[model samples]
Target: MFIFQAAAPGTSIIRRDLGAEPLPQTEALYAVALASPATLAAPPMGSLNLSEALIREVEAADVIVIGTPMHNLTIPSVLKAWIDQILRVGRTMKSTPSGKVGMLRDRPVYIGVASGGFFTGERANQPDFLTPYLSLALSSIGLKTQQFLTLQGPPHWIGARHR
Candidate 1:
């Protein structure tokens, strides 16, 4: 359920060089119930074939790499929708007294994030909501180890913009 963005030219964001299966960026719109009795009852699967396939990919992959653009200081709606599709009730995770516990095996998730403003490092001027939110979201599904590489201020942040 990765609402991924297209990778930069000559860059392989989805490949970890560990024979990781590469999943194409899912641009299709996805908005469905996060969890249901029918889906939760059996093996966690999406009501739609697309979501089901996405879930299976994530499950099988040894590592996950996501390339996305920060939209308005948060993830795009499409990404959120994709996330909703994968975070299943009984499949990817389960509700426990302590909290929602993850059922999937832990893995490393590398994310290449692009931003128009500085979210970290020196001369910071923006509130970074994307990192924390993504951390919690991915961790909920047992993808504990994560590394984020951000390209901030792109071509638009130079000279006067920096000053």
Candidate 2:
């Protein structure tokens, strides 16, 4: 929801709160679903123009950090919609005889995930499909370096003293 960009010690920190001004969900979904070689190659208009704007923001970033709350053991629908808007063929990736290759320069993608229940290791009660899926998704777009920061535990256990 909040994107924080770290800068030099004396430099000012840049912040963009995507949550403050959320994009229309219906518009995002339609843009992604209808995106194709022809649609992207055509004159930049309407939703395609919007997609271009989102792509520009992503392309301009040096480090991309995503803070997301886990919903139903995975990313929320709105976040998925945002991902769909940015991950465009020929822009983020391209097809070739070998396969699809990422066009964006490789960068660090830090994911901050907050979950209600245990979602890691042997004590985990819930299945974690978010981490792997996100990793692959980002890698496919050339953001290979990734780091995850997770805070997991039920609300009831937050202030309980250990025996």
Q: Rate the local accuracy (lDDT) of all candidates.
A: 0.69, 0.72
| lDDT (tens digit, per residue) of candidate 2 on 1-163 | 2223233443333344556766556465456546666666663356566667877877887777888878898887767767776676778877678876788898888898888887886558989888888877787778888999887776776663111
| Superposition error at 149 for model 2 (Å) | 1.1
List ranges where model 2 is wrong by over 4 Å. 1-7, 10-14, 26-36, 96-99, 159-163
Q: Which consecutive 10 residues in model 2 have the weakest lDDT in total?
A: 1-10
Candidate 1 per-residue C-alpha lDDT over 55-152 given as tens digits, one digit per residue, 9 for 90 to 100: 78788777688777788998866677667667766768888899988888998898887888888877678898998998888999888999998878
Let me know the TM-score candidate 2 reaches against the reference structure.
0.79
**TM-score of every candidate:** 0.70, 0.79
lDDT for 25 in candidate 1 is: 42
Clashes of each: 0, 0
- In terms of lDDT, the poorest run of 10 residues in model 1 is 10-19
- Cand. 1 TM to true fold: 0.70
